[model samples]
Target: MTADSEISEQPIEPATDVRPVDSEVVLARGHLHPAILLLRLLDAMRQSVVTVVAGLALGLPWLLAIAAGMFLLQLGYALARYLTLEYRLTATELRVREGLLHRQERRIPLDRIQDLGFESTILRRALGLTVVLVETASGSGVEARLDALSRSHADHLREVLLEARREIVAAQQAEDDAITGPGTADASAADNSTATASTAADEPEWLVHRSTSKELFLRGLTDLRLSAFVVTGFALFEMADYLGFLTQMSGVARGVRDWFAQFDPVVLGLLLLVLLLVVISFGVITGTVGNLVQFHGFQLTLRGSVLHRRFGLLTTRQKTLPRDRIQRVTIEQPWLRRATGYGVVKADSAGGSRAQGEDTAGGWDVVVPLTRLENAFALLPALLPGLEREHLPWQRGSRRLVMRTTIVGVLIGLAGAAALWSTAGSLALLALLTIPIWALLGILAFRNLAYALGDRFLALQHGIVGRYIAYLPTAKIQSVVVRQSPVEQLLGLAELTVHVAGGSPTRLPDLTIENALELRGELARIAAIAAARDWQTRANATATRPPADRVGESQLDPAAPPAGDRRPWTEPRGDGPAADEDHDRPGGAPPDSSRPL
Candidate 1:
């Protein structure tokens, strides 16, 4: 056939569903909104409240004007920043460019992107904007936060970025297979392309689950932080009085103090008891109400490989965690929640941040703040997909676990009683009551201690007043430790700890020494296998790239040097007819050692 006819006869391949990789594409640009500037201003003020209050305390008219000027300057700067903020997307990277005085460009590879979350404060949400937080597995607690994007745009961007990551992974797997050998028939590129096409097509996404207002309210009520907030609120109230904001209230407080000073011993005791009761009541009310506001309409949504959580009362927080990025899953059930058959499910990821208190804002993101135990169990498969769930054979602690715990609790109780003996005399004997209570606690804790080994996960369950179940992927485990104390040595019991990338290690104590050691070996073997597979996969991917010069196919050598020699692949060698053929082949020249061999 003539060249023109041959060209026309060759069928043209159809275009792919995915976009071509081009750095010039502007996926979305962030436009500054007045509400965003206002939110930023408020956040600044909240962060520097003490400085602002001090400036106000100077009581100078000029200071007030200066503060106003400063606020305006900050607002103007925020506006400028928002105007400069823009992001671009390519097949492999998400590029963010922003700066006023100095130019900055951030290019995050899609492969490194561990999470893509969309958060919105009440003001932003009202304005139809979302704050997109991009977390990479860089081992840095910091995340790239893009503010003032429309909610729809943010969601779309998140979807595109995640799909791009999946595409990259699929391409890499194909390359790896090409190098190593053919992959399974099911995992072929044609199948993958077809699946990608269907997914990219107009497939309606479904809502996985959402938290009810009642469930969130119950979560807030069960929050242990509620107890601590009582003290914080009292301190704030005292600060307000000291600042002269509540002159009338301060007078009442002084009057109460005077009344208390004049009370007899028995009356003073009764007043103290009443004060404690009042404080407890106040704490309960404040804590529960605060939690209710913070998690008013918490919702969990799933779209393919990503799980998104949207929550908040004042500052609506949205967290997106990739199923593969999750390092561990913890299910916590306090006595109260357990009694009501409710539990909280939390997930820890490699790129997650540590938060204080209940960690509602941290990396310990709550998958389900409050749900029925059975429902929570059912929800796990959805949250962490691709993993098989099985009923593992649990290894219960020995009876010695109970005895050891009782002895330790008794010692602690005795120490406390002895410390109080000189001050309270016979009344100190009342402290002895803690012994039985602690013993019962120890017994309950021992009873709850159990662990099971899954094919790819380690499940640990423990706790007394509260029940904790931690599921750790064997592949993510950094190390396993088996420790024994002197007492434990005599009893042949040990503690087993499984450490992951970040966060506290999950521990199962009072295991038999034999069992703990056996577990350690098993974990080590699994870790080794996982590491080897990753290494081989990476090498295969690297080796599968097409040669730069197609004319010199002979130059693409395939054999490795003998074990004793450490020569490079391109080094000249006498390796039989293959080497001679490479040297004499048409359109090929001798290997160049000067050029990096």
Candidate 2:
């Protein structure tokens, strides 16, 4: 045996580090609790009911039989899956093995893990069970799940996995130090390493923000999803009407029909309008109650590098996001909330779906559900420390934005007018009257359109009835594009899109061509610098790393990138004719994000 292996067989002194190396440990096997079978059965019942209702609507007896058979099949499958499901975590990987006849297994590396979110329904909570969703940096949905784990086991697994990741990162750092020489690393790398070490050695910076019952209720009251509520009420009324007619037992419906038949067309229209108002009122109330339920007891806690969110009344949820994984931050205000000075702050990271049934899960994690504008601003620096001082003052877009938006609105109004003319005869000209209203909306949209840039970040604000302001570090941007349409070209206007990791591109429309290109070039340089800094860090880190770790490979792609290419940021293409070169033209600009509209 080798000297190291022989020495490992001996008991270490107490002064030596007792932490186990990742490769030397084997995680204990994990089994899904029997409760999973029960949960699956309940889910199957819900699906069965939906299937039966849909099938019954078709007036087909075979479909009912099929639905029953499907439910039974699903029940059996759930039982089988519960019996076969198994999970284990080793030093370097998480292993999940399931399936009976078709046997499936997945081995996810610890380094590949991006985040983990925990959830518990009312039923599951009562049973002391939780579901853990495992996500990777692939930007898709949850990659793996451990359903129906005991609450304690779930917590333990989370701690173990997170701790494993930290150990691996430390190992990588150590290897990098050996290769790059201690204290001689790149300036940026040294700063990051120092910050990480200091954070670990220092007292935990933990802050918890809780929403009071009064505030949460007010939040629901102000949500005001009027249109959604109207649609819901209408659907319920239609269903009730149809059921009454089908049973031939709806006196209310018959009376309504008779009353409607007695009224003149104009009077009937007025009554319908009144009825719409009543439905909308009911919808507003229902929406308010829904909002209350979803955000009740909302709490956000930041401990060290991870953020924790817990909320909901009927179904409690807990989500965990590492600050380092966050790619973008957004602040949003709907008209109702804006009037109340409330804003919803959200953070988008590389992976994981938001908690189930959390209405604010619009491809991001809601950091602050309903906070005052100032509070939202206060929370932003903690969530996005890199852009604290880098964001530029917001600048309004060009007047071309107003013209384009107004034109689009006018086209929509024309379509509405034609439809109304066909249906209401003499009332068709009313469509032209609506043009002013549409134009007002267009003006609102134009007023909200703005963009900002900083030394290391880019931000855009837009939306009409609701506003969304999104910001991301320039380094996190994946690509930049500037495009011009024929109409826009004539107006000397162009649109720019900054594509960031893990979220939709932030688009800034209607800027002068000079501004757009200038912005694009600056963004390209910033992104290139960030990319290069990260690349060099990786190169230094992996220089002494063992081949087994494959630290040089990308998180999503295991292959090493091509070498010896010139750095895009360092090129001298910033001067002269090359600067004016349009990417759409051959031998012009390099393939940027620009494309003809």
Candidate 3:
């Protein structure tokens, strides 16, 4: 039977209170809005348009038939999916069931939910529909997507889910306190604030940041890169060739060259310079227009624990990221942006993947896309409550790091010179000129390579022409490794890599071996404590569940101590090297090798 036939015609009403009285009772259950079918059909048509055009141009009847068949198949599948799909919201989990020939079901625990985002294309908006995306800590990016729901229903669902999650977390925290006495004063204060926030009839939202047209223009102006110009030139050339305009362009080029041939050398050089300037101007204008469209009417607001971002002109997007889910926040000041005193702030949450290009158009991780340097730093405290930009105790790497980088840069310059020797002959000597530039870059890099470890955060600063400062919460660190390459070992230096949930691992290169080990151990200890606290909360929550539903205590967390073990979580597990012991062998280590701790 179709979901529409089985379910009532009336939509599920929003819950007055999402707090759990019974775990198994359904809070809401409904099928996707009927408009989903139209959206799906439109998508199918869009996909087939190219095929249909190609078939018509090639005068191939069979190709048209194939395209028609594909369209029909897609329409049939969409119909089947719409008819079978149903979602249920319980106190403990959000359940989705769908399928016809093959049955499928998904049960996402309320506590694991990290984010709920809304998106609407021009078509969807006109139809009063929205797409809801659900994310978890599963690391596969979006875990579930509910397409084309009524806007009101989508908002109601988001509210229900977030409220339910908050209730669950609060209950877990109370249970934790019963066992562990009490948490830190800051945690207690946060819990109180959360409680106060939840008691309100409506969660008040405050506008945190808004991008003006001027800021958007500057963002695009400074977003320039040589790669963008090269790509644009290549694309234009290919298009000209494909459209049979290359010959015309070549004739024009020949005419211009012949005209220039009659001019003096200095005049030709000046003309060439003007042409280059014009090309650059064109690129910058194009880029600026693109950004203006993409970020028009951008706004960021804070509602309770979640940050809500809304932007885009043609396709409006609304992204909700919980402050607690943010694993890392990076402030980027590229050369041009730095020169303009502007910077961009991006965040990595446990809900999304970095491979998805979180900073690109249509992605949701940019907290502050563009702002003045001081303003950008000032906004961090709002996103990360306890962060103090000026108070961080930054520490630079050893001077050996500078020497090592300089040597590597010089070697690269020499290699380039050697590679060009045969082609450019005497002109190859110009390659050696890069050595001074490389040396300067090395010095700049060393100056930028600094890290600060705070009680609750780890801040890393690095880069040469640009500056990047990443702030990572200690509780979010999954693993810490100290790695020593052969050259690093010779220099008595090592690199530290800290792994978090959703983004690339953060690296601090060129630290003394002793320092690397010390930092690794400290981070590991902090992670262990966090893991233990998480375990206690989970265990307590599981205790209230039925025996069959409860998770196995020993399997709760690999990094956590086993259930009923009374040992302090901060103590070493004795599975690795001692803190005071030497990491190297009795003699010198082998060359061109590496090891991870």
Candidate 4:
């Protein structure tokens, strides 16, 4: 109202900086396109089908009435999604406004956004529509999603989000204007800031990274994870047979059932043995074939915040996961890779849902394209550039002990095999072979297990079958544990487990006592830096604390977290924007993605 108001009326000057000051911001894409409505319609239909199927499975009484009810309900809901959902991207916020009679709205300020992921199912891809997932500040429980927009629109939206976030950060840092030297901190900060902003805009710069559709297809074709998924699918059916969820609907299952139904008591024992063998065989085939399918011709691209990967022949898919949503990054190579000087890169993204009780998400959205070991450093800034040091290395003591323990494990496994064969009979053939595979796997585990450090970066690479490389800031670590089992105790061995929010521990086994504690302390220090969210040095800080009642109402009570919860918060490293605006959210407010900052 004073001098500032009088100046505001003046004509604008062309300034170099286009950034914003507040940590909170409005979005860039606002109009709800028809395609987006179509996606909501599709989702409503799918949910309706699931509900109906569930009812039938539970034996709903009055079949015809139930069927009729389901049809009407589904149709009604789908129609509602089409008419009511309004996905919007504003200048400073991503807002979801919807309602039939009573409208509702939820907004996410760009600065608090952690990630964005694009997903395209076969149908959605055909429709040229994709989903944009947004990960928010709290890192757990609630998320916002833009259900349906064309692939190009989704990409553009990602860019807008990035730009907004950067503007906010720039404004916040306007005061001190602290600029670190170009040598170290500069590179790391630039990487994170760039990743955070470019995820959306990065795609446009693809003239430099343009991949042919064929390349994307081929990349998907030989993806080890897909192959692993296929193989594991078979195993899951076996597990389901044991626990009774999903089952093989093939002739073999039918034959087995018929035989069991018609068999005499004398044949039951034989039948049981056959079933057990089938399970073991399935597991073996799954493990082997999955390796073939998943990593056949893997290739990955790292340009800006987008990490693009494609692998699969029959049901091909290509994905571009923005760096901001990269909750955890991992690099893994079998000892085979050590020989080739090549490794696999897999990232933990926000889109996939976790199978309850499992260490990793059952259907995690992963990008597996073969990559170079050295590139690990190059990609560090984008994924997590706030690591304590310039470089992180493998825990030497742990690696050595683990390698030695592998050799010893072979000796013990052989002893066990001999005893087991004497008692269990010929089935022990597989167990006997385990002695060698274990030794080999152990050797590979030790040889392949490595952690590379880069300025403000920590990268973890391990595993043979299910290899992974995780990128995380020291700040992301919630806790560190050092434990030893009796066998390890006798051998002066211990295990170090660093717990990040909502992820399985990176277990480094058979480490010396001194190394285990040392590693823990080192990680903790890094975490301290990451958690250092001091705002004092900033020109300004803009934060959006949702209405208190709404925040409390929407959040998962921290007191009642998922069981065996690792992090005190236990929020995994995030969700994308797809679920950001939840006027139609099932519960009060969905959990903000549990993710790295």
Candidate 5:
């Protein structure tokens, strides 16, 4: 063991150093809770169960020895980690140090932290421990994890970290105002005063949303997908095969099939229908139960600029996200949910993996899991200030888009009929019956597709059977592009795509070429302005910091447009809109102007 580990494992001693009143000081310092050792060992055992069982069954002494050796190594590593890992909270940053041979340390600035999340499984909960996850704007997943900290310590650490981050941000904002002149000082002062008053009063967080049992059940019911049941059935079969029960299960299935064959054809059809119903019912019940376990006691609250979310039954989770980090808010309405007047609200921030499947499993990114459609829209302003769904001046695409879509659908119908002609002969004529349905779908798609450019947000709404409305902050937009396929070019139609951090690009398809070009230029200009403002803010903040801690200008604003590239939007590309074209044209007119929120 290293000297650091030796000292850390010993009992705590009183500090002897005297520090100045205004100097940086350590707020908290400690190793993970002792329960982590047992937790790690349990995890190791769980993972090795299959190997151990196989070894014993096969009477392979060497395999058993290998498993035993691996278990011991894991146990030793866990013990070393428990003894050496130390986390320290300083005034400006959180420092974590570990390792005995290759000593390493990680220092994360409090202001850069995006969220602090806590999770506890049944075992950890039983031990009064929780896992702390630290996230940052690194475009990665969790940046740091402190597994199995005492619940009280974890909660206390969260409060301290958030308070420190707020103070740092306020200080930076004040410094920026000082550097930029007196124009923003009054607003800064007012914000500071509000924060101070809230802190002084120890005000309780304002409850934003809560999920009841009925709501959770409805959420699960509306969220049902046939794909999930199909996947589950396949997983069950795989597990049965792994456990050496596949042969017996197959024999039982064959016997049931034989019995069903003995019944009348009409009765067999009815029996099959009943079986399908039973399967559907079982899927619904399982889905509801899973939802209940995942989202029980769900609640969301706002404390100043931070949003707090708490939920779950068997594995509870508590997460905090700052409002400023959010890049976009998406409101989703599946066909069933739309029919039931329900919708889901999700928010993507500046960092973390963009895995929607994982998000659903862990309830990540979801601001409001399930709520009434109107209520879901109502919650938008809470996340992004000044956003009002009813006030948006939504713009629809050209009518030609509908016609183009209908043509494509009809073509597809013809193709399908041609492919089936040889196999089904005259019966293939039934494929033409789908043409009307496709045309109706195209019309619905046209009606649902719309885009709105507000002062601070760019909103896009689209979908046919299911609907999605995405509100992306103009300041967070990273890139804008206009794309046209050969068919679209022939039809004078184009697609505009806007990219943002930590999420997939949002596309506004089936737009007229003129409108697409105009929108792309406007969005690009907005992104450049946002980047310039961010650079100024960062420069001011850097000026206030000590020279030794300062970063380069390029590092301060990596998103800034290249020098002399500011007017790329105004420049003409080959075969695209001309730079000298009149802006007053119907489709080329700029969007309505609105004051910044």
Candidate 6:
């Protein structure tokens, strides 16, 4: 941060004109309990049991009887393990405090935590476990869980987190004041605010920000990522298959069975058909089922001006991820999602949890996960007053890619199908099946191709879903790219990749050359104006091109002066030339390394 920016940071204070404040308490929290680990292992093992039972359900009567016996044995072991497991909680941090004889304790301080997300699957809810995730950027993080704890205990832990944070903040402010001459009340308030874990709880109630359900849903829908969706879907399908629904499904597919039986075909042929059907079934079931359960029963509630959500089926999960954590926010519309008027929304939070985070850490950085479609823009003003959704700069070209790819793919598939038909009669069906596959691929390629959402925060709305919103404060971003690969060049397009902190990148593809270039220039100019770090400004101002004879940094902008004589990346100069090459390192054209967003 620049000296001016630092100076500009005024002392912050909340007016005391309103109502009396609630009592601040120093609550004690327990260490991570051991029962939590046992519970997790139990859940995992339960999944295995479910697999066996499902398999047995599809087997012959005698096999089913055997499976029942095996299930009983396994269940007995699980019950024993659960009863023997040991876990406890403490006031300052969770003390895993497990094991019958030899024990281990992992301590995670609440003060260092950046996130306190909660999780409860349908079964976990029934079992009464609100999986507590104590998240931090530092590798020293903890999952302080209290499985099957009564509601009172869960509430108590949350209260303890607040207390710990308040204590830490108050202590920090006291220390800083001693060193900095006790600047302003506002500054103290700001310090205290951040120290409290969330802006909502720390700052005065009126000063807190809130986002509605519509806004929350939009955020969730926009962050949807195709890779995540694909992976999650596949995993769900595999699990479902392990449940042996397919075998039962096959039994009901009597027409198919009868058709094969009549043909007197080789057993291999019957197996191949069933396999193909299973794969298709997996995809369809996974995609549809995953979406339904995740997006179901989603609701956004605001308390004391803080936007929070309560979601999940069997076990309800509630979260109050602060808006300030969001560095960038985006909304997206895939063809299918768009057709349904659903727009997914996401935000980038530096050093925060991931949306829908895994159970172990940073439960979910995302504020809204799998929100409904119709309202992406309704919630922007909560953080950014004027931000609005903008269409992808290169959306139209998706149609072209979709049509062309579909045709080519179909042709290749037809050719392959023809070749295989003579060797294996079932292969002839490929000609018919390939069309849907190619078309779907085309849809994905097309739908996933375009991207948009750039404003003050540098938002990029990409991905199909499970969506991702990689947020970074503009100041945290290192650089922005507008480059054209040969493919893009041929297609008169360029891809815009926004560089961010933590190496999480966001890409906007198939943008028109003109649009991409405009964005590049606009961002470059913004980089200069918005930079609060003096050193960064100076480096950018004096950045020099590489030498004419070299491909290094020296040749980048020869028109400028030597880089050695130039100031750092953020120093502003009133009289310096547009750029100075005097300080150039004769060889390197490396730009000032902006902190990766």
Candidate 6 C-alpha lDDT tens digits along 54-135: 6667765665556567666666654544455443333334444444455565655444454555767776565556666555
lDDT of each: 0.61, 0.63, 0.68, 0.48, 0.67, 0.45
Candidate 4 per-residue lDDT over residues 1-597, each given as its tens digit: 142343345443232232344424345544445665556556656656665676688777565466567666666665665577766655456677766667788776555564565555667777787666565543331256666667777777777767666555555344213332232332234333433343334333221122234333333333334354455557655653663322246677766666555877668657655765665566556644554454334444444444555444322334455443455666555444534444545555443333222233222344544444443333433333232123233332354544455657666767777778988777655565655666676655554454533334445545555444566544446677899776577666678777766555666665677766776777777655443321110111223211011111112222232111212211212222223231221111112212101
Q: For model 3, what is the alpha-carbon lDDT of residue 44?
A: 91
Candidate 6 — worst ten consecutive residues by lDDT sum?
544-553
Model 3's TM-score against the true structure: 0.76
Candidate 5 Cα RMSD (Å): 13.0
Ranking by lDDT: 3, 5, 2, 1, 4, 6
Model 3 bad stretches (over 4 Å): 1-27, 90-93, 109-115, 136-141, 159-201, 226-272, 353-359, 389-391, 422-424, 542-597
* RMSD after Cα superposition, model 2: 12.4
Number of the top candidate by TM-score?
A: 5
Q: What is candidate 1's lDDT per residue for 282-325, written digit by digit as tens?
A: 76677678777776687776543446677777778776555545
Mark the 10 consecutive residues where model 1 has the least summed lDDT.
545-554
lDDT of 6: 0.45
TM, every model:
0.71, 0.74, 0.76, 0.55, 0.77, 0.52
| C-alpha RMSD by candidate, in order | 18.3, 12.4, 13.1, 15.4, 13.0, 15.6
